[model samples]
Target: MFTLKTATSFEETIKKSLFICHATPITSAEEALAFFQTYHQADATHNCWAFKLTQSYRFNDDGEPGGTAGRPILQAIEGQELVNVAVLVIRYFGGIKLGTGGLVRAYGGTAAKCLHQAEKEKIIPTTLIRCTATFSEMAMVKSRLWQEGVQLISEDFTENGVCWILSIPDEQLDVLSAVYTNITRGRIFEKIET
Candidate 1:
């Protein structure tokens, strides 16, 4: 999966109707709602939208025909294999009526264009792990984690040992766990956090 690196927008006129598409990366439904509320046009004819987050997704046609606006916008996002993204398409009617097909094309095309123009980055699946090691094993553990590209989130030193919080890519978890065990002689304890 991929996601936009920054907010982006595109505007075009179709059949004399103004269509403006705004796309933003969002990790949660609350952020998606906030983006819609902030960018929605009060006086425009419609404010259609769509968002995709992992296994969840939603779309709104606003006042346009049932599937004319929102679904197409969603298809555009999915077509690019984008996740954790929200797209809002605002329309200002210019008195020229566009058929349902036209509306779909306009909204979906605008959204596709906006996302295509924006910079994107790959989404790396990550897992959080908390572990404890004796002070004598700290240096080796930290070194192994760093060599495996594990992100050290926090470290707390206790009288008994050092507690570490790390973010490890899903693909590297097993390798890191093995390396940690080998380096510490199976003395360290680890817990995975969701």
Candidate 2:
């Protein structure tokens, strides 16, 4: 799965209706809701939205015809195999009405265009590693991990050294484990999980 590296937007007028779509990568449902609320156009005819998370998803027609607005937006997101994304399409009626089919096409097309133009990044699966190193080994071990793209989530100073909570990409787990073992001789390397 992939997600937008940065938020993006697209605007177009179709059949005299103005449609503005905002697409953003989100990490949580709360963030998605917040994005929708932040971009919702109170003065528009409708503010439809949809979001796809790793394990969950939701869409709102926002008073549009059932299955007309929101579902198409969600389909656009899924069709692109994107996760952790939220899309909001605001419509300002321009004194003309688009049929249900037109509405779906307009909203879905707008969202697709926005996402297509966005910069994307792959979602790397990661695992948490807990390791303890003596004071003397700490600097070297931490520097090597950083060089390998390991992210230090937290560090707790212990009596003898520092216990590190690291986020390591799954593809590099084996290599990192070997580095740790070789550096510390497997003395303080503790556990890796999740």
Candidate 3:
């Protein structure tokens, strides 16, 4: 799955109605709700939204026809194979009334355009590792791990050395373990279970 690199938005006037879509990368349902609340326009005719997560998804058409606004927006997100993302499409009635089909096209098209233009990155699987290094090996271990693209989540200094918590790409586990072993001469290296 992929997610937006950053929050992005698109605005266009379709059939005299203005549609504004804001897409944001989200980690949780709460974050999605917060984004919706923060971006919803009160004076606008409708503030439709949708969110896709790893475990769940939701959509709201606001006041538009049951499926015209929200479902199309969700489909747009899924069409892009996106997860952990939220999209909010705000509408300001432009004197002209667009039928159901027009509403769906405007909302979905705007969201799709916004997402297509935004930069995105892949989500790689990661493994958490906990290890300890001796005082003499601490600096070398940390530096080498960083060089290998390991995320050093935390480091707790202890009398003997430093306790390290690292986030390593799953594919690099074996290589990273070998590097850690070589640096610390087979010191304490353990996988942390979530």
TM-score of each: 0.95, 0.84, 0.82
Q: Which stretches of candidate 2 lie over 4 Å from their true place?
A: 136-140, 178-194
Q: Rank the candidates by TM-score, best first.
A: 1, 2, 3
| Model 1 segments more than 4 A misplaced | 187-191
In candidate 1, what residue range of length 10 has the lowest lDDT sum? 185-194
Question: What is the descending lDDT order?
Answer: 1, 3, 2
Could you give candidate 2's per-residue lDDT for residues 99-164 as a string of tens digits?
899888998999899888889998887888788888998888887776556788998998999888
Q: What tens-digit string does per-residue lDDT give for candidate 3 at 2-78? A: 98899999999997888999999999999999999999899999999999997899999998999999999999999
User: What TM-score does candidate 3 get on C-alpha atoms?
Assistant: 0.82
What count of clashes does model 1 give?
Answer: 0
Clashing pairs in 3: none
Tens-place lDDT digits, model 1, residues 1-194: 99999999999898888899999999899999999999999999999999999989999999888999999999999999999999999999999888988888999999999999999999989888888888888888887787555788898999988888888888988888888888878844366755
Superposition-based RMSD of candidate 3 using all C-alpha atoms, in angstroms = 2.7
For candidate 1, list the clashing residue pairs, or say none.
none
